[model samples]
Target: MVEVTPPEGSQVVIEMWSDLGCPWCYVAKHRLRAAIAQRPDADRFKIVIRSFQLDPRAPRKPEKNEQAFIRAHGGTAAQVFQAERQMQAIAREEGLEFSLDRLHANTFDLHRVVRYANDDGRGFEFFSNVQDGFFAGALNPYVPDALEGVAEAVGLSGHRVREILASNEYADRVRADRAEGLELGATGVPFVVFDRRVAAPGAQKVPGYGRLLEHVAGPVPSERVS
Candidate 1:
């Protein structure tokens, strides 16, 4: 029952539900950004990054690599490996480098920290930084030091971040975000709602996002009839 309102003067408010560890969510974000950039009134759009956990039961420690995680989750070795390769190719198309060797872990704490950042208007930036670091294989976010490094990179207070992680700060917001998304009919990550009017599911292509934006916000002034 959380209320979502567009920022002042914004023509469109884009709320996206995605997990930090989901590869398709990463790609979908990039595509959405690309679509926004292509718009003449790009600055009129406000994006809110909603939280979702692909696996709430995941371990806090990096106990297994991507392959092992997939296999343990019921995917065959051949299917998992092939899917990883395909994902890599798809990610590359979105200007991201993917290395599926990274370890899997629960993202609840990460979501908590990001929710804290949302209060300061740095949530999306912080989330993107962590995802970039994780997917690049440059760091394991499950580790406190690595998580702190990303927070610092995003200009977040290291002490504040540590304190939030030490406690359950923003935990309710994280859970509420996921709950709201589910209520809105999202069954998976990368679910997007434009101006709370058009609901789009999955990691759609760049043009697909553009179309959704246009559908909700309508054509820019230049394209409007006098």
Candidate 2:
């Protein structure tokens, strides 16, 4: 497991287990960040992104369209249509774009790269950029070059990014993260633990996350009267 130490003076450490291919995880990320920004002591919170793969056996390259992929995975055609529409609406509410044309492939490599970024202290930025590119249909991360593009955009070294992708570096860290999440009772993506005490499963609304923060970390201190 990647050992993460909270920043100096950080009061709450939030560990979120999420899969990049999951739209709800993308939306939950935005909601959580929005909630954090609303707090006066936002800087006191530390967020650690954990890796989870919704489809561990998926192919490295996307061979089917989104509809076909969902259907092949046991989702009925009707269910796929309804779920995609609902998720698009929800993503819009969170100020994020969702596309039904997103690539469906194994995220193990992506997780490995994220683990490397986490160790390098650029985890969130790299993860967010990759998610944005993915859901926007602007880039296919399944391609090595596109993945390298995201790493470069996040200020990660090009050579290091290529090296990690070409080898098994950080692969064990990714697996360890997913195992830890399951041990913590995560049955799905977007599972979050606040300070390792409060366990929140699934995608929670912005205000719900706000309440959680307040409950675990206390309310923002009231501004002093002049």
Candidate 3:
């Protein structure tokens, strides 16, 4: 078990690189929540969700079959089914519903929408909406209607969303985030770096994450006893 004492004054910054549609990312979010809940100084943690695209060039609406997508992720049928079960169990733990059957591979538009949502003072709301659409509503967030629906659910004006989606203004921001993710050696979703010392990729479990945070928050005692 890892022992953590929150920084007394300064908040611990956790930069999370996650794709909104990634199931592992979703599970990781819940795991983080659990860690935070256990921490005595949970209130001092600040989490920033950064954008990362699993497929930068995925279609506006995924035209490929789910099996094909799964295979490309190095996912076998057995693994996929196991993930399905795990996801279901995680959703239950998080008190959320996640349906992978209706998921798609397209993420460009969704990322663009997040840009607009960030500008509209609805970043967290928009993020939740997107998460809900994918994990609960069983909606493919890349479609125009689904994207718009999330924006609306987050209280972003329809006009602002339409204008932003029509233009290329936020495209570069999203692109830059993805580029940064790549530069950070993030090859998979839910990559997190705590205090620049511990780097974990792909939805780390609670024990590992908590240990990393604790290590970052303070010095670990030397194992060698004088």
Candidate 4:
């Protein structure tokens, strides 16, 4: 088991567990960002992005569009289409566009990049670019150019990002994040922890999140760890 020390008595920590491929995770992230932006005590709010795998057994390479993937997983056309509509509607609400029919790649490499960004203080910007590239720009996360573009956008070396993806750096960090998600009883992506006192399992409403932030902002959980 991994050991973590929760914040000292009055610190508010937010840990977000998400998959780069999950549309709702993207939406949930924005809602959380909004929640933080509206916080009365923004200085005390800490945000940490954790990792989760929607398909733990996903292939290393992306083979085709998401449509074929759905079928391969035994999803019916009607159901898949409906899900696409739902995703698009929500994306629109969140000021994003969705082309769920486009190619979907394994996010293992991209997530590693984000982990690096976190260490370098560019996590949020890098994470935003990854989602924007995939869900909005229809870019394949596995492609070197797409991944590098995000890196460059966030003031990191694209070449370095490519190097990290080519190697096994940060792989353990990704695994640890996933393990923590399971420990938190997260059955899906977009799992959120507020000061470690409250756990939100999915994409929640914005207004409710704003209120939750205010409530959670008051007291930190006792001896909880990220």
Candidate 5:
């Protein structure tokens, strides 16, 4: 269990730059939640996950397995295998079931769909799906049908998702998000900016987050100081 205190006059806003297909980002989200749970005034903080595509040029449909995808994306065969083991370990620790076999290497279409979801008052829907679909379900997020399925799973309109896929609206927003992500110094997925001051590059432990949040709120004052 953790202890919490009332929020100070200052509020904490977290700008999270992440890629939907990044396993590390999902783990980071879980760690962030743990930190929030420790704070009594968690409501004083607003967290938003922005988009940052790791593979901006990825095709709409990738033709590779998880191992090949990782290798093509800069990691070697051994490295990819090690990463898979690490991902499995982390998923287990987080109490999440991971389906790595079902994952596809592409994320462009998935990202485009998410942009449309934002406009339909379900901005969080696609984001939530990516978190689960990529990190847990290990589904090919770039496929149109897969993305549509994700939308349906999240209670969003499947028809709308299909419509977005057919149009250019969603793709434009994906471009915008990528631009903003770069401007915000998020060159990689799962980059986090906390309290507009502290920044973390990837998935960190709960204690690190706790310390950061505490700094944002400052120290609790004694009654005599008041």
Candidate 6:
């Protein structure tokens, strides 16, 4: 079990820049969660998700599998397949499932849902559910009804989701998040920034995050501090 509180001056805040269609980002999310859970003072830490779009050129519908989109965007299918296998192995270790057959759709609206979730104070849970919907079940986020279903499942109103999809609600927030990531020197997704003190870029391991957290929150002596 983890404590909701930690020693004074020991709180850590992490900002993760990620995209829904990015395989490594999904793995990174799981690793962060697992690492936090391992700490006795998990609740003292907060993980804020910052949006990034790996495939902004991706269509708004499911035209093909992710590989096809990547191929159309210039990468070879074999390359995508090889990367998928490696990522799937890592995801499995983190108790996450990946559906490589899923379509690669534009993530703009999906990110809007994330902002709304943040407004509702359920951003983290909504982000987790979106990851599961995309990687575990291949749900297409650009599909309005499908996205609404996901929002409803996470306790968000389907009507509100539909409204968001219908308009440009929270669109600026998504763009602002990406801008912040870029300003932080991120040229890619899965960039983890810890309290403006440390920045790690990639699908880092659980222990890697643990080390970062420890460094940020100070040493945990005898697990009592945590």
For 18-123, candidate 6 gives per-residue lDDT tens digits of 8887878888888888888887678878888889987777777665564555756668778778877887887887788877677766788889988998788677
Using TM-score as the measure, the top candidate is: 2
Determine which window of 10 residues in candidate 5 has minimal summed lDDT.
Answer: 1-10
RMSD in angstroms, all models?
3.2, 3.4, 6.3, 5.8, 5.4, 4.5
Question: On a 0 to 1 TM-score scale, where does candidate 6 land against the true structure?
Answer: 0.87
Error of 3 at 110 (Å): 1.1
lDDT per prediction? Answer: 0.83, 0.83, 0.71, 0.76, 0.69, 0.79
Q: Which residue segments of model 5 deviate by more than 4 Å? A: 1-11, 67-78, 119-122, 138-140, 152-155, 218-226
TM-score of each: 0.90, 0.91, 0.76, 0.84, 0.77, 0.87
**Model 4 vs truth, CA RMSD:** 5.8
Candidate 6 clash figure, as a count: 0
1 against 6, candidate with superior TM-score: 1
lDDT of 1 by residue, 121-174 (tens): 788888888888888888788877877888888888888889998999998899
Ranking of all candidate structures by their TM-score, best first: 2, 1, 6, 4, 5, 3
Candidate 1 residue-wise lDDT at 198? 77
Q: Candidate 3: worst 10 consecutive residues by lDDT?
A: 1-10
Candidate 5: C-alpha lDDT: 0.69
lDDT of 5 at 153: 78
Which stretches in model 1 have alpha-carbon errors above 4 Å?
1-11, 223-226
Please give the lDDT score at residue 84 for candidate 6: 78
Judged by whole-model lDDT over C-alpha atoms, candidate 4 comes out at 0.76
Instruction: Tell me the lDDT of model 4 at 56.
Output: 66
C-alpha RMSD of candidate 2: 3.4
